[model samples]
Target: MSRKRSRLSSEEEMSSKLSDGGCGEGQNGSETSITSATSQAPIDALQSLRQAAPYSTEPEAIAERERCHYGRIPRAAALAGTAHRKVRVYSDGIYDMFHQGHARQLQQAKTVFPNVYLIVGVCSDSLTHSRKGRTVMTEDERYEAVRHCRYVDEVVRDAPWEYDEEFLEKHKIDFVAHDDIPYTTEDCEDTYALIKAKDMFVATQRTEGVSTSDIVARIVRDYDIYVRRNLARGYSAKELNVGFLNEKKFRLQNKMDDLKEKGKKVMTNIGEKRVDILTKWEEKSRELIDAFLLLFGPDGRLSNIWNESKGRLMQALSQPPSPRGSPPPGENGDSHSPVHSRSSVSPPPPKSRRYETLYEAQAGNWMHRALNVLATRKRPHSGS
Candidate 1:
């Protein structure tokens, strides 16, 4: 009986050991499973994030990126509401020269919808012509150019007709953006209404002086000479009659008058042999008057008086000396002589008519002649 009891106790001890070892193994397995699950939690979270994130290269994705970069909604995006937080701005144009004014407008639009994305709507060349007569650049060129702007987010070809609510709603637009100019109202009512209906914002910002029309006007003005020449060929008789060419003629006539006054003065200075002075005066006066009339007047009766006067002066200056020797005692030399003997002849009276006319005509001649001489004179002492 003592042997049987001892054997039963040994058997119980073995069973107890087996049970405890089994429990220990089970606990180790549970810990391994928990560690595996914890390691996989981050991987599962990353997979979910990847699914929720937007796809790059998609229009919507591109728009969002642009909005984030510029910190505002695009004009077209604002006009086309795709998201509740997104603002749509609609600016349609050829966008030929993307200058500071364009930048300012985009900047202003962003200011209105700080959280929205921007979508640029570029008008096709055909569509632009329907509204703006003509555009400097083509549609493709405008699109490519505007797309490169840092302020511009996305580009789409705008429709030919005016903006409609259906179009705005399809895109989920929130705002219609424009420059703060009063003239844009007539054409933008439909788009404006859509923005209001959507409870979206309407933003108008000030633009700098950079407009396609203004640029074209400046180009025309700067090349006025070429434009005028072409215009003259195509202009009708009535158009030509409005004194456009006559304005140039009038200016020429004034120049002739100035020359006439100058000649008159020169003649007055030649005193006693006054005929010689008068002859020279007539010739120079005629030349200036002829040049004036040639420029301003028709090819009619105005004579080449200046040419004739110049010929007469030359002939007088070239005449041979008098046949007889110097004049009789006490009498001054020949009237036409240029002798400078002060003791031989008494001075002419100050009140002489010839002297007076000479003084008047030559009053400003010396100064003018001096200026002309100085202008044409070679500079010997040039710093260079």
Candidate 2:
């Protein structure tokens, strides 16, 4: 990419064009015409040089070579482009979980100068681990992702987290391009501040809406599936700090049964003491709908209500149970649990070992029923 080499390439190209013209006209038997035609090559070359945009130290020569390259530009118009130095701009990052935002920043870096040489640097995995803890993709995978982007001209491996005088000098980087956000690390000064002093800072816009961290957060939000995925990838439960689903499913199923029992009791009282059977059914239906709304929040989706209701039930169940020797409950004092309460209020459950998977067939039924509840979504046609 040196100016001397560029000059040679252009000279070779011009000679080829002149040779083609000479051969086409030689059969016409006019040496004078041929000589006159040959003289115009230098004139054309000079015009191509002088009237054109500056490209390098030797702008005219480099422009001529570029003019003949691949899809040829008109000699005159090719010369008339805006002059731009062949810029070697540096942009570096962890580039973890490469996505559209990374691509946008690379595009920003390339757009800073016309005819730019964009070099993207990816941090080594160890360095990335030290700073960012963990990344979904390995360093090499991230490097390949960045390397294949249309805006990137080259990729430097094992790049440092912070740009320094040595790195800039070694790469012959003209400007350090990145977002304006200040990067503070124990290993270096604010990266932007350091580059600003040298006047080589070219701040590009940080892309909005999407980021690597945001993607990681979304993965975290789907807590159970994420832990399972890690387990599938050879990570252990201890590593993930999660437990088996069997016991939790059992406890959750126990809580659901307790709620259903309380709901039926509420319906029974409506029939026996408050009104006729049809009115009791109608009131019971309204109560169930209200409970469903509270469990599912504003969206009213039932998909995860089983787990959500389970968590809420845990708080209610955690209270210690009263001594059984005393009058069973609700006769003269607060009921021992919601299932036995006189008003059928859905209060806490008394402590019991019923959450254990003692019977194999019963445990299987509980798990199957819990899974079904977790999978179900609210139907548009349903009243509740």
lDDT of 2 by residue, 210-295 (tens): 99999988887986566545555677667776677743554465567679999999988876876576776897998888888876
User: Which candidate has the highest lDDT of all?
Assistant: 2
Candidate 2: residue pairs that collide: 52-79
How far is 340's C-alpha from truth in model 2 (Å)?
76
Per-candidate TM equals: 0.36, 0.42
Question: lDDT values of the candidates?
Answer: 0.56, 0.66
- RMSD in Å for all candidates: 33.6, 33.4
Candidate 2: Cα lDDT at 174: 66
lDDT of 2 at 102: 94
